[model samples]
Target: MKQINIFSIIAAFIGLPVLFSSCEDVLDKKPLDLIAEDDVWMDASLAQANIYGMYENLNYFSHWNGDPITYRSGGEGYYGWDYYNSYNSDCQADLYWGHWLSGRGKDDTGWTPSTDFGWDAFSLIRKTNIAINHLTSEESRNSIGVSVANDMLGQVYLLKAAFYFMQARKYGGWVIVDEVLDDIGAVAGSDESAAQKLKLPRATLQETYDYTIDLCEKAANLLNTDAPSGQINKGSAYALLSEIALHGAAYLSYYDGINVDAYYQKVIKSVEELDALKKYSLVSGAEEYKNMFSDYAYAQTCPENILVSQMNESYGYRDAPYSHINRLLVNFGTALLNNNINQSFQSLDKGYSMTNAGAQIQPDPQMVEKAYYVIDLDRKARRFEESQLFAENIDIVMEEDRWVPGAMREKRKLKPTSSYTSISDLMYSRRDQRLAGTFVYDGSEFLGNTIYFRTGGNIHRDSYVDKAREMGSMTGILYSKRVPQYREIVGNLNCTNPIFRLGRCYLNVAEAYLSLSTPNEAKAKEYINKTRVQHGGLPALTTETGGELKMIYLDERVAELNMENDRYLTLLRTALSWGVTDPTTGYPTGEKGGIIPELNRGNNPTKKLEIEVPGDYMVEEDFMKPNAYFYREIQVPQSDHNFIFTPKKRYLLPVPQSELIENENLWQNKNWE
Candidate 1:
C-alpha cells in the first residue's frame, strides 16, 4: 500500500508562510495551473501523470508512515510503546495515545493535522474518481465512451477499493465519500441537518467492506496485469480483488470477533485467483534482489514482480533501512566495522554517548512474540516463539561499568574507547539474513578497502575525528539502502523501487492455505522450499515452523518480508481487541481487556521490558521500559462493544472526518464516540 507521510505535507506547506503579498492571489493557485482534469484525463499520458502523483504520495506511506518497522523496529516506532514509558506495546496504548478527545477537533490524531498517509489514500480515491468523471463526461460516455470509461473506471474502483480497505482497517468506523469534494464552501452552523452534514458519522463496517469488495469486482473485470503499468490491468485488478477479500476477511474475523466462514471463503476464492495469475515469479540472487529494487528490474523482472512502484532518482519526492551507514551507528562498531559516530553529534557529556539516533523504530516484544505462533511450513528448521526473535542482547550493567556480553571474543573485541552494546552483535550478528542484505556490516568486504566499522576512522563517534585514536575490531552495522545512491557510484536510468514483488504472493497463498485448516504439509513445504531455493538455502528449512503446517505463516512471512513494511501489518493481521481502556467504560464500545488484566491468558508470562538509553536520556513513548499502562494493563474484554469495525472494514480506512461533513450521503465510522 503506497501512502504519503507528514514529511511530504510538511515540505508542501513549508513555503506558504514565507510569502508576503496583499491581494496577488498568487498563493491561491493549484499545483499545476490551467491544466485541470477537464483537459488532462482526455489524454492517456496526462491521466497517467495523475496516477503517478498518486503513486508518489502512496510510496512514503507504504515505506515509512504505514510501515510496520517504522513503529516496531528496535522499539523505536509505535510498535514498541513499552519501550516508551508513557505508552506500552499493547493496542490499548495506541487508542489511549490516540485518545478520542486528543484526536478530535482538528488535532492531528483525528483530522485537523490529518495524517499525510491517510490523506494520500483518500486523495487517491478522489483522484481516481476525477479521472472517471472526466473520462465519462457526457461527451465521452455518449460516444462509444462506455467501454473506455468502464476500463478506466474499473481501474479507479480497483485503486479506490484498495484505498477504502486500508481505511476500514485503520480507522474502523470510516465515512464513505463516493465522489470528490470540490469544496467545503462554508460550515453551516449547528442546525439539525447542518450538524449532521458538518460532522460525518462513521459508516457501518459492513457498508465499507461491501462497497470496497463491490468496487474490486467491478475493477477485476477490466484490469489485466499484462496491460501497461500505467493502467490497472487484469493481473493488478484480480490480484487486488483477491487481496481485498483476503485482507477483508482477516480484518472482519478479528474485529467482529466471529470466525465467519464467509470471510474464510473470500480468502480462499481470492487465493484461487492469485494461483491463476501467470505474470509473476520470485526473483533470486543477492545482486538480482538488489538490482530488482533498482530501475534495472524492468527488463529482467522476476516472474514474481506483478506491480512495482515507479522509481527514479528524481521527478518525485520520496525515500529505506537498506542503510550501510546507520547500521554502523547502531552496532556501535562491532564485528569488523568501527562505529560510525557523526563527530558533529558527539558531545562529551561526562562519559555519556548521547545523540538523538535518527528516528529508530523498534518492534514490540508482544507482537514479535506472536509471529512465532503464525506457523509456516516453509522456512524455519527450528520450533520457537517470540523468545526466538534474537534482538540485539543489550547488557548495560554496573559491573565493570560496561554492558559487555561475558564472551571472551566479545569482551576482548570490545572497542576500548566505546560505550554500550549487546554481548551478541544484535544489529549485525547471525539473525534474519535480510539484515546482511539490507545493511553493510562491519568487516564485510565493500569497495576496494574494508568498509566495516573501524576504531579511529572519521565514522567513529569521537567529538573530533582527528583525536579519535583507538581502532579495535569493528562490529557496527550501517544501512544505506534508501540513502540517495549518487549517480557517480550508480547509474540512475537503471534503478527501480521494488514495489510489488512475487515473494508476498507466496505468503498470501500460504496464509490462505493455513486458514483453510487442512493445510497440506507437502504443499506448504513445497512453497517454503521454493522460496529458499531462490536464496540458495535448503528448501525444507521451515520444517521446524510447526509439526503441522499452521505454525510457519509468520516465520515464512518474516523470512520474505522482514522490515519491508509488513511487520506492522503482520501484527495488525492479528488485530486483537486492539483499543484503549476508559476507566469509566468497562471495555468501551468495542475492545478487549488488556495489560494488567491478565494480559497473557495462561502460563504465558506477562511482558516485561528493559530499554537501554544514554544515562541522561528520558524514556519516551516509543523508547520506554515495559509496564507502562498498556504493557501492564489487562486483556480487553471480549464482547460486541469491544469490536469496532468488521473484518471487511479492516481492509479500508475511514474517510476523513472533514470530508464526511461536506458530503451529505457520507457518514462517520460507528466507532466514533
Candidate 2:
C-alpha cells in the first residue's frame, strides 16, 4: 500500500479555476495563467493533481462534524454556529421546535433553492467528466503509463459516482451528464448553442441508482485491491455499491420499476464481494473501538477505516481554531448527545430472550427502575468518600473571584476522586461499552479532565454568568464519538474522518437480509450479532425474529453507527419499511415516509438531577455528618423542546432555482414544484 500526501497535492492545485467554477463558467472563460487542458493530460503529475483537487472538492460536500446533515439526523446537536445553534435534525423532522421558531422549513416564505437543500455539485461532476475524458484518451495513455492512467481513471469514476450518489440520495434523481461538451464553444455566443447543449432533462430515481451502481462497478474493476487508507480502492467501490443498493431496495422499489428483492440481492452481492477481499475488519476491544476515530488509530493504520477524508497538520489541513470539533463539542460547548439516544444502548450482560411469538423480549422497566435506585445509593456513598479525600489532600484557592481547587501543593498529591461514579456510569458502564465511548455525561473523563454536566457543576449551562458563555449541553450530555482524547488543544488536531468501514458494511448486509421479500431472520441475526459482540462487548443476539428482529437491527445501527451513518436517510427508509404513507397523495411512500407527516414526533427535554452540596466546603466536620448525601434524587421540571413534523413533500430537494432558470429543460422535485 502506497501512502499519498493528497492534501499537499490539493494545496498545490488549489488555484485551478476549472475545479472551482460551474460548467457554464468553466467553458465560457478559460484563464490564461492556469494549466492548459492539453498539458494536464500530457503530464502525469498535473493529471494526478487534478484528481487530488476532486478529492478536496469532496470535503465541501462530505458528511463530517461541520455538515448540517450530522445535526439533521438527530445524531448530535449543533450550537454556537449562528445558523444551526441549539438545533439538530429533529428540528426539520418535527422531533423538536427549532424549525418553526427559526422559520427555516421548506414551506417557509424565505426558503430558497439556493439554501443547503438545493443540488449544487454538478461542477464537481463536470470536473470528473473532464478528468475521465482526458484520462481515458489513447494519447494520454501513451503519455502517462497505462497503469497510472487506469488508476486515475478509476478514482474519477468513483468520484463522479459519489457526487451523483450524494445528490441522488437527497434529490432522488439528477440530470445525467457523462460527456464533456468541450466543442459547445463559448457561452457568450449569440446563437445560444452551447447553453442549449447543457440543458438535459433529469433522470428518474431508478435511472440515477443504475448510473451510480454501474460506475461503482467499473471503479471496483479498475481500482487497486491494496490501495492505502483514505484513497479509493476496490473496497471503497463495493462499500458504496452496498450502500446505494440498500437505499434503492428500500426507496426506489416503491415508485420506480425495480424489484425490492433484486435490490436487496444486489446489496448482499456487493457486501460479499467486499468481504472476500479481506482488506478490512472491525477494530476489536472497547478501547480499540473508541480509538478507531482518534489519532492513535490513524497512526497505527486502523483496520476499520475503508475510506477516509484525511486531515493532516503537516499539510496545513488543521481544523479552524474557533469552530473545531472539540471547541464545538467541549470548549464552546455547542453540541450534546441526545438524551433519548443516550438511553438506548442495550445492557452488556443481557441477551434477547425469545417470546412465545418467537420475538425477543426486552428487560422489564420496573427492574431497570430498581437498578437505578440501587446505583444512585452507591453513587452517593462513593461521592462522600471522594469529598473527604479532596478536602484532606487538595487546597482551595481564589481564582478570578471564584473559589477553585488549587493545583497539587508541595508534598500532598491529590488522590483520584470518585467523580467518575455518576448516575451515567451506573446507567451506561454495565450496558454497551460503545455508549461510554460515544458520549460524555456528568462524570465521564475526557482529554484527562473530569467533565461535569450536572446542574451547578462546572460544565453546566447555568454555571456561566454571561449569556454568550451559556453554550454547554442542554441535554446534560456531550458527544465523544470520533473526538480525539489525546489532544488538549484542537486548533491543529489531525485525524481521519471515516467515510466507510466494515462494521457499517456488516449492518448493511443485516438490513438487506432482514428486508428481503422472505426475510432471512437467521442470517440477519448473525450479521447483527457480529457488531453486538465484537464492537459493543454485548452478548450474542439469539431468537430475535420478524418485526422484533427489525427493531433490534435499527437499535444496533444507532448504537454502532449513529454519528457516522446518514441517520436521517435510515429513519426515512425505516418509515417506508413500516408502511408509513405520504400525506398529500395518501400513497404508501416507500423510504420517503415520516418526513411529511406528524409521525415519530418526540421531545428531548433537558433533565437536571438535583444534587445536595454541603455548605462550608473547608469544614471537615461537614463531610463527617451522618446525613451528608450527594444526590437528592430530585429532577428539575423538563424543558419543553417538543417536535412538530411539518406536512410537506421534503423527501427530495428542489433543483436549484438558479439552475432551473439557466437550464429551462430541468424540472424541480415532485413536491418542491
Candidate 3:
C-alpha cells in the first residue's frame, strides 16, 4: 500500500493523541494511549480521534525563516515551505534563490517535475479522504451516534475542502481523489500496468474549484453550529466558502468568464451567512485590537476569529516558539544593522540578553512605503505638523533617545545626543493605531522596553556581517506584529492563528462589489469603512473612483494582513484580474496589465542637520564628518527590486517531478518548461 494511505489508516485506527480541547474551554480529554484499528470506528469518541489528525497539516503562515544568503535549510521544518518571507515576491523579506522566478529549479528539468514548493499534498488528501469515507459509511455512523457521525463527517469534509483548495490555487489542475482506494493492494503490487491504468489524471481547474466548493457546502450543512474553539463548524465552512468564492470570482473575471458575477454573489452571500451566525464580531478599540495579536488569552476570546487553529502547552499542538518568531523578524539579540554614515557605536550587550537576539530581518523599504498609505498625508501635514518629519522622512528623523530608556521614553525631552523629536509622540500617541501595532519604529515602546531601529550608523557593536547580504538596515524601522505580549504568561506562544475574521470578509465584499460591471461605490466604501473606522480611526472612504478604491483596499490588506502570509497571493490574484506590463523590462505577459516588478534595496539621500549640540556629543552619529553630519539612510528602491513577474509561469507553481512520473497522464502547468 502507498505510505500516504497506510499512515493515515494506521493513525485513524490506532487513535493518535490529538484531542478536542479549546483555547480556553477544556472538553473531555482523550487518552494518550492508542486504540486498535478494528475498534476505532466502533465508537463516536474513537472516530473523532481520527478527525483531529486532519488539522495537523494546516499551515500557520509566518514560519518562513531560513539562511537569507544561502537559501538552503531553514523554517519550522513543516510550515512556510513557500519560502514566503525571503522569496521577496510580495513580502518584505529578502530573497535567496532568485532563479525560481524564471521557471527553473531542481525539479524543472524536462525529464522530471519540481519539488520547489514541496507540493506533495497528496498524502494529506488521501488521509483526509480515507477519514471522510469511513465516517460517512453506514456501519461507522450507526456505531458513532447520528449527531456525532454528522459532526465528524463535517469536520473531515472541511479539511478535505481546504486541502483541495490549496492544491487548486497552487497547481491550478489537480487529481481529484474523493474516495479511499481499496485497491491499494494492486497499486503496491507488481502489476505496474494495472496501477498505471488506475492512476487518475488531472482534472480541469474549474472542476477542481467547483468540487472544493461542493465539499465546503456539504461540510457546512453537516458541521455543528456550536462547536468549540479550534474545531471546524458551520461558520468556518462559510468563511472558507467566501474566500473560495472571491478567488473564483476574481480568476473568472480575469478571463471574462460568464459566471463571474454569480461567483461574486456567492462571495457576498457566504460572508453575510457567516456574519448571521453571530458567533464572531470584530474586536473594537485600539487596545482590544492589539490584544487579538499580542495576547493569547485575549485572542481566544476575540469574537472576530472564525476559523482559528489553537496552540496549547499542556497537550494541544503548540506553534513555533515566541523566541523563534522574534528572531526571524526582529533579529532580537544579534543586532544586524546597516552601517550607515556617521553612525553611533552599538554594543550587542545593550540589546536583549538572549543568545539568539541579533539575527534580525528588518522590514523591506517597500514595507515602509506601504505603511504611509494608512495615514492621511494632507491631514497630518495640516493638523499635526510635528508628525510630518516622522511620516515623510522617517529614515532621517526617527532617532533613538539614547539617554532615556524604557518607560521613561514617553516623558523624556529630546536629548542632545538623540535625533529624537516630538515625531514619535505625534505618530504613536495620536496617529492610526495599526501603525504602532504592526511595526516597531524608532521611538516606539514595546513592553515598556525602548525599541531602536535607527539608520545612519552601525547600531550593533557585534553585528552579524552576513545580514548585509540579507540587506540589514538601520532605518529606525523593524517589523513586529503578533509577537508575545509583555504581560502574557511566559512560554505561551501558542496563539490562535486567525484563518477568517470579519475584517477580511468586509474586504472581500468591497473587492467583489468593485469588480462588478457597474461598481457599487457606496456599498464598497461601506464595507471598507467598517474596517478603517473600527481599527484605525481613519476617515471613511466616500469619493474615490474604483481604481483608487482598489489601491486603498490593497493598502489595507498589507497593513493588516502582511505578516499573516497573504501578500504574494494578493499580488498574484490582483495581477490576474488585470494584467500589467513590466515597466523596466517592457515584457507583457498578457493582453491586460498584470506584471509586478521585483524591487531591490535602495539608499535614502543624505540629509544635513543643524544641531545645537557638538558632533562629539551626538549619539545618533558616532563618527564626526568634516563639515556636517551626512546621514545616509537605506531605502527601498523605487524601481525593480531585483525581480519581475513572468506572468502565467510565475503565478502557478510547477507540479512536482515525482508526481509526473507517478501519474504519466498528468500534464505539467503551461509555460513551466
lDDT of each: 0.39, 0.54, 0.52
Best by lDDT: 2
**Local lDDT at 246 for model 2:** 86
What C-alpha lDDT does candidate 2 achieve relative to the native structure?
A: 0.54
Question: For candidate 3, lDDT tens digit of each residue in 1-673?
Answer: 0011212333445435443222111111222224554477777766665666556444332322311111222354343333323332233222212222211121212222353454555556655665676677788888878788888888888888887776666667678876444333232354436555447788877778788889899998898887754567888788788777777666655544555777778788888888787777777666776766666677666777665544544332133421234333323333344343232333333323332233234454334444434344454311222345333533333444443343121121243443444434433454556767766654465544554333232332123444432333333455556665454223334444456667778787877787666777789888888877788677767676545566667666666665564666666666666444243322333445244543222222211111122344235432222112122323333221233344554556677667777778788876466
Candidate 3's TM-score? 0.73
lDDT of candidate 2 over 351-401, digit per residue (tens): 211111100011112112211111123222112123333354333332221
TM-score on alpha carbons, each prediction: 0.58, 0.73, 0.73
User: In model 2, where is the ten-residue run with the lowest total lDDT?
Assistant: 354-363
Across residues 325-430, which tens digit of lDDT does each residue of candidate 1 receive?
1211222222223234323322222221212122122222343323222222333333222223221122222323132355221112223233324322332333
| Candidate of highest TM-score | 3
What lDDT is reached at residue 529 by model 2?
Answer: 82
lDDT at 15, model 2? 70
Clash count per candidate: 132, 3, 28
lDDT of 2 at 485: 70
RMSD to truth, every model = 12.4, 12.6, 9.4
